[model samples]
Target: MLGRVLGGISTSLFFATFECWMVAEHRRCGFGEELLRYMFGLMFSVQYLAAIGAGLVAQAAASVVPLTRLSASSSWHYGGYTAPFDISLACLLLAIPAIQMSWTENYGNNKAGAAGTGIAASLRAGARAMGSSWQVPILGLAVATFEGSMYCFVFNWTPALDAGGGLPPPHGLIFSSFMMACMCGSSFFGMLDSSYRPVKVLLPVILTAAAALGLTALSLARGSTSNGAVFAGFLIFEACVGAYFPCVGTVKSEVVPEEARAGVYNVYRVPLNAFVIFLLLTDISPATQFGACCCLLSVAAGAVWLLGRVEQTR
Candidate 1:
């Protein structure tokens, strides 16, 4: 109990410190638009690195330290063994809010003098408009659904394809390679000018096609299909899904006002968490079925694209 309490407090403090640092960074840079974008990218990269490092450390520790020894020393049962790690991860995720709060406060307080009342009023008005709009909520749900589905498919599909479809390890390697393709896609998308509207780029149609391909791959797996065909389909699907990220980021930025963007992004996380819980509760066959359901959801997301395009036209 004491260790858990201490861990939580320590994690919160670390997050608070990181947030303060991010805020200071924003202020020191004078919140220049280009600077903010680069900062966000850098922070994202750093966070990913931190996550990787933490995972490696946890894996190493698990390998060397017997669970029995740790359990005995920590007075934990098998059921409660994962709690410490969970608490640590919770602390790590809290850094996101800390950083957001810091940046928000910096903009709200420091930049107020320069923009004066008009800028503040505009921000307030945007917030109010956002609060009253169903569009933001709907867009958020679409984004969350897409994100959750992609994660579920990736996590569940690889093993299913290996076991059920008789695909070898090479297929899994192909999936990783497809992820690398996505990294390239992200870099390509990032290079495009901010003036380029992602919706106009036909991201919805591309995502819909990807979902179709994913479903096709699953169907092939179910039908005892050839490994080559299934692998090729998976690769194509993963590549397209990888390309979807930049468009999603751009859409989120365009739809949500800057002041409200963080809050809106946070709200999207709720559905993602719910989806993860749903995945956890599902059996293997059910998880595969859920992936198929996600493919259908992607078709629905394409409809969201039409709605978004209409809004853009307006």
Candidate 2:
């Protein structure tokens, strides 16, 4: 429960930071075409890597410590060790505005061309660039919603599958393998993106359909005489989830303005919070109903992709 709370808080802080960073970057870049490319490659790399390190350290500490002890202390005191992880997180959150200030000083005042615009003008230009595109904002919302729903379904269903469906420990391994497949899928998609506009990419729809098929197979296997079919369906479903993930971020980046990319990316997080509340409050059968929900979400995601394309054409 504490983990969930902390995770939510952390996610919120992360998005807040991202939004601030986006606005700052826009102010700094003066609506430059390649602002996102620059920010993602340089600034975001540092921020994300720091976040990853923090997560790893936190995980390692939790693994070694007793949960009760950790919760008992006001600080992050666990077992026999006391570390400043909480303090560090707090400090990181506080540092976001400072980081923005630094970015503003560095790039916000620079003249890119003969326009000789001030930082305020640059920010306005960036805002205008973002406001020019409706596709970016809608796609951003869709990506966030899809991701939040996916996480909720996965978290709620996995344990239910283990208990209700009688899936063994090996099922966890299968899930991990599915994640690896997703990494591969993302790499494949990146390569494809080099040759095509990400919005024109059809992989999201294809993968969504595949995921739906997998879920449908699982649903059909619920009353099956053979367990093999059910297990295979689970594996297929997981793989499809993995394959579809890359498209979510790609779509966001493709549609959002260069300056507002981070802010738009952060907006994708709302679905996650909403989904958690949904899972907690709802009394649905995890395996059967949740699988149906997954299928429905996949269909909806595919429809979103199609609608985005139609909007693009018009």
The top-ranked prediction according to TM-score is: 1
User: Per-residue CA lDDT of candidate 2, range 67-129, in tens?
Assistant: 444465466444422433554667668888887776543222333542555446544554565
lDDT of 2 at 248: 46
Q: Provide the lowest-lDDT 10-residue window in model 2.
A: 105-114
- Tell me the number of clashing residue pairs for each predicted model: 0, 2
lDDT of 1 at 114: 35
Candidate 1 per-residue C-alpha lDDT over 133-248 given as tens digits, one digit per residue, 9 for 90 to 100: 66676666666666666666666656655654442454323444555545544445555566656655435535654565566545654765445555555555555454455455
> Over 4 Å off in model 2, which ranges?
12-132, 164-175, 202-221, 224-231, 295-299
Q: Which candidate comes out best when scored by lDDT?
A: 1
- What is the Å distance of residue 132 in model 1 from its true position? 2.2
Alpha carbon deviation, residue 261, candidate 2 (Å): 3.5
